[model samples]
Target: MGQHLTIVDHPLVKHKLTLMRKVDTSTASFRQLLREISLLLAYEVTRDLELTSVTIQTPLQPMEAPILEGKKLALVSILRAGNGLLDGILELIPAARVGFVGMYRDPETLQPVEYYSKLPNLLEERMTIVVDPMLATGNSSVAAIDLVKKKGAKNIIFLCLLAAPEGVARMKEAHPDVPIVTAALDECLNDHGYIVPGLGDAGDRIFGTK
Candidate 1:
């Protein structure tokens, strides 16, 4: 079975994504656009979060209200570019536990190697949402997911701002159970392995680095 990849077509998300895609958008504007898009993505990603009813006293009388059920969520960010998405999601899920998995590509092997990994306690009990701005080859995202799974995260969702078809297919093959949500699925990756017509190097654009 293929992994579920949802391209959030919400109006606001589409607008911000366009701004981010423009070559002329300034670094400040690019960073702000990313934050806005992430928040919109987070909203769609968490739409199905479990909620339970509770009885509480209101200003006038007692009434039943619904509150989040199950364990608090865990937001695992694939470092560097992923950190850009992490900030906005955190603003909405303020109580969510934060985790980081840092990986760097080996120039020789062209493989992802973990430099750091840390997650919250009781990961198995929490609904973990992993964020990475771009899913190109899917190697880094897959490795990050494996790390979290080893830490006992059964319920996982992969969130990205943009994705390539190859990357999405790779992830589905590796982990069919994980759902992938993204802003857009672009054309094939170019010869340099960057998503075609994709926002140039998300990390570089957002941070104003080379």
Candidate 2:
């Protein structure tokens, strides 16, 4: 809804996402699809990263080319499902530092409770990207952002494979300064709070659980 949310509609992204959404897709295929889609999403998400000129020798001659500048990136994975997307983004930016945030919902309250969290040094100085496979209710996502903010990260980017409108709205309301990037925005959340017509439980699908 806000200008910060970038829903990537690239054809290749759409194609890969469709495959990942199929009911019959295997764990192997699902993992591969997540990796591929993550790469595509990372490409779009990092478009505005600062660049600096560097001297290099080209095949034809010596030249000064622009390369990524400023503080190194810090990727914060929202545990399990987020790890799938994290792998591919790390492949692209190997120099980027890695962090993890794990939260599990309480069975009765259905509220997110943190289990684990760790971050890189100078977090406030680096561009931080948080990856989560699905943004269903947005509670976990918001809580994750809260944790990161506590660590003093100002420039934060949230990346997910799929999102629901409710989750998006919730995120914007909670953290207007953070931008979200996702492959698809689905219809609505079902009674159980799962994204309807959504690829069933992303964590389960990625790990081949029921």
Candidate 3:
């Protein structure tokens, strides 16, 4: 994964992830855990955001306060599963501009097929964070990032709850510049393109579907 991938090894994050992995975990619990974990991941993902100072008056006196520079960042959810992580991160960064890119994998080829995309304007002016719960084959993520970049997004980051080695390699080959943040980098992907030891189908678990 090199420097492009960062694993959030916080104990709280891992504990919640464990609960989420259990097959018996309820939908409400899974949803809540995902939201909490995303907030922790969000903290790490935005660790390097550029900050500028602003003068502010406190009870003590006037002081220089650090504030994020430039326009609010954009959060692009790779829908269905992405929305799970999105709901959580949104709580941490409610001021961020929201967008969505809807895509699905072809069961046979395991390739991404885009059906919808509604991104925020002025991508060139804001940092874009692409969110998805799982990164398995990574085809969807690569395709989504390609769209974001073409729309003039210069600064980009890929955030997910779990990442597979195959997916990490795919992203590195396609977008070496963009960094990836995840709760864990699991073992290799299964033959069907699902991450092993993964929390089953994140979309299904989150939405309480079969």
Question: Highest TM-score, which number?
Answer: 3
Q: Score candidate 3 by lDDT.
A: 0.94
Which segments of candidate 1 are over 4 A away from where they belong? 1-3
Q: Which model, 1 or 3, shows the larger lDDT?
A: 3
- Per-candidate TM-scores read 0.96, 0.95, 0.97
Best by lDDT, which number? 3
> lDDT at 136 for candidate 2?
85
* Model 3 per-residue lDDT at 63: 97
Better of 1 and 2 by TM-score: 1
Candidate 1 residue pairs that clash: none
> What's the lDDT for all of these models?
0.92, 0.92, 0.94
Q: Tens-digit lDDT track for model 2 on 116-203?
A: 9998888899999999989988999999999999999998999999999999999999999999999999999987888888899899
- Candidate 2 lowest-lDDT run of ten: 103-112
Model 2 clash pairs?
none
Whole-model lDDT, model 2: 0.92
Q: After superposition, how far is residue 38 of candidate 3 from its true place, in Å?
A: 0.4
For candidate 3, lDDT tens digit of each residue in 24-118? 99999999999999999999999989999999999999999999999999999998899999988889999999999999999999999999999
| Candidate 3 to native Cα RMSD, angstroms | 1.3
